[model samples]
Target: FGKENPLKANEWVRTFGATAGDPEGARLNLWAPAEARSAGGKSEIGYWGMELGRMLVESEQMPVCLINGAVGGTRIDQHQRNVADPEDVRTIYGRLLWRVRAAGLTHGIRAILWHQGENDQGADGPTGGFGYETYEKYFVSLAGDWKRDYPNVQRYYAFQIWPKSCAMGVNGSDNRLRDVQRRLPRLFSNLTVIATLGVKPPGGCHFPAAGYAQFAGYLHPLMRQQLYGHARTASEFPGLQRAYFVSQRRDEVVLEFDQPMQWSDSLMNQFFLAGQSGLVQSGAVEGNRVILKLREPAAGTSITYLDSARWNPENLLIGVNGLAALTFCDVPIDEQ
Candidate 1:
């Protein structure tokens, strides 16, 4: 395989296979099992993969293959392996490489879709919760190693860790992990962290079947914009750009977005200002911008939107495209 033989890696290009009822042409495998089920029936339906592949094939008018090597309840550490040890097939990372070789996909790996970190946030396990800094270290290392092994893979997409049902303190820690995920793009240019704010989890930590399908709905448009470059309008995927104080009084802080604002009254309620007084009040949206009215001078204040440690059924800072605005905190008001 590619691990033992460097020349074999070049053979991982597009290949064709013929199966029952399917023609002898290039086809994308929806998931590893082809059933789109995982984690003891607590995982997504792989609608995202199927829809993404469909978009690519239809838009480009070419055949493309999509494969999944994801396993539920696995921590980032479980996937982080020693790339130098080619014979070490102990981790999921090793198994992933083996699967790639088995599938004869050594030539190209366009992108990797990652949705993990829930298991890492748990309190009990060998790979239990860690600080954001530590989590970032592990994740960056993992991505770097994967890219090193699969040189054809240039882009990595990951879903932000969604809200979970945990103790208040644990929830806070999980939010920090989510923040780490959000900042991953800053660390790695090829990485894009998809927001999972509006998608509600069905029960413990898994998205419902409907949630998975809806998540695919959100991802498809993003892929169109980010990957295919079809939707060139900002209205397709609204995201926060910068936040700063617009007034010398420091009472009002303005939030700027990548797209035009479609402000709603309910979205205004989601904004919060944390100052020395703990939780300050917020104000209404004004013309594609959110104004935060602090109770006091915002010298040491931080503005956060949809920043909840626990599940909030009413968190509604959605973009015009129906995707939720990413949770963010901008402080040092004068520095903007």
Candidate 2:
């Protein structure tokens, strides 16, 4: 999401059909710090792809080809294919499909880095009534198409958008969309969601060069863990597994994570007791769980963390893999 001009070229990286003239999808030389340039270096350089590809090539000691068919400000529904001709070149989905087929990568794709939902979330662009349920439906359809099209695709890395700076007039919609994105892994076996809350330069809807580079940094290890079966710590997302009260003190709730995690003390106010007057007064990291001390009793109240669409925290609760916790909304608390 950064870079006005192309950077140095990486010989190990290549692109297929970045221009209209290249119908055969020739493997053209790409220019960037570590990524294949989109539109033959005529478009903005996405550092995430560039750096991630560089890491992959360095780790595997082989060349990697990137086929990017992303259209900016497109809704998830726009990516849906026409059933009559799924690969119709006139449509967005078809164009991507056409490129994949033309490049002979219909069965060779290792992973898909899905970073979208700005427009669909009613933030940066028109939503057209694309709400939570509609998004889930369209995403499911798209995933189905991918499953059928890219039969060999191993990983589906979904990026959960940071709604704070992105929200325009629809804060609820933004948060809901993010929640849906965070829950995508539960819907698909190969899908994993990456949190974007911790990325730096979080001023505008699009991040700066360093932010996109951080995105790549977060993705590389996870990709290695999934694609190469490498056991890398901090590669796994520190997602919330459950929330419950550990003892008779109804003022405190324990958030259990899926993996061991670490946190900064500055995020006490980030946790919210839904419908409750006071915020989380304090928090402690213990092994894989976090104990949040609330100003009021949290009984019968739902819990949320970093869920506000306009709240951007400088500090984050990161996992062993250096990834932040996926933002959650209205996560019900259980009495344990």
Candidate 3:
């Protein structure tokens, strides 16, 4: 996911300033235009944040506000805090902080929907050697700064960038960054990773309106469960539990998921093996596990999914709830 530039009329409107219909006296007051009406009589439909807010307002009958801070074509370093002056508007992080404070929302933030990293995934330039360790360090510092500033913020919904959307050519470093992103939840207690593997209209660095709407559809329900305690019976978000060889020979590997899985298509060619194996000849679902049959004897010491960052829109391994599996790279294959 990326910034929705030139925001559509009703998709998202100014929450602060006189334009939002706040008291003209307080020009800086920020308010959620939950029922905001344009000059026309019809109510406005939305894409990502708006759609999610609409669902929350309709289902829970509560007001939801989205404070968007995403800036297109920005690297992780650009978002680093200006420790010398946290409110220095010249810096990206400082500017966002200044805006939030100006709107009297320093403490009102409940969650953050973060969709970035496209700019940082480039094969060269700023992202040339920006592997997992560098990104993790920068992001950790960013998160710490946020927690210090916005103490009440509870959740961080980070969107894992797809290889197809990388601004530069795909490489192992890009997928390595993705692997780090998908593992963010483990690094922070309040963070959760949202996979972008199977999202539609996926060729661009930024998704179109329809693709974002689809993303909102997948996100709203999980938000309901996480923030509202709506669905507590089972895991609403699914992830890879473990991957291991089915036998010592390693001819077959099994990818176990936290939930039952289903494939959208026959081809699971996205998987690759390292070590002695040639390739993943074929794969199939067996209950909660994906059995990958190697063309040769199973001798690989490691396995990787979404190998080479191939973009397959229709073919995906998804959970029963329809959430796609997060791309994992060089996951160690456990011996039986």
**Clash count, one per candidate:** 2, 4, 2
Arranged by TM-score with the best first, the candidates are 2, 3, 1
Cα deviation of 52 in candidate 3 (Å)? 2.0
Ranking by lDDT: 2, 3, 1
Error of 1 at 67 (Å): 2.3
Q: Give the per-residue lDDT digits (tens) of candidate 2, residues 10-35.
A: 87776654433333332233232334
lDDT of 1 by residue, 137-230 (tens): 8888888777776778867878876655332225455656666777777888777777766665533465555567656666665666666667
Query: Which residue runs does candidate 3 get wrong by more than 4 Å?
Result: 1-14, 17-46, 123-128, 233-237, 263-265, 275-278
lDDT winner between candidates 1 and 3: 3
Error of 3 at 335 (Å): 1.7
Per-model RMSD to reference: 8.6, 3.8, 5.3
User: Per-residue lDDT tens digits of candidate 3, residues 1-336?
Assistant: 333332433323334322222233223344545222232212222357666766677777776666555556777888889889986655667656765788788898778788888766654435556545477888899999998999898888888887746554345667777888877877897787887766787645666666877778777777788888886544345677789988878788889987888754355567777722247777788778888888777555777777544555667667787778888878888988
Q: Residue 101 CA error for candidate 2 (Å)?
A: 0.8
Most accurate candidate by lDDT: 2
Better of 1 and 3 by TM-score: 3
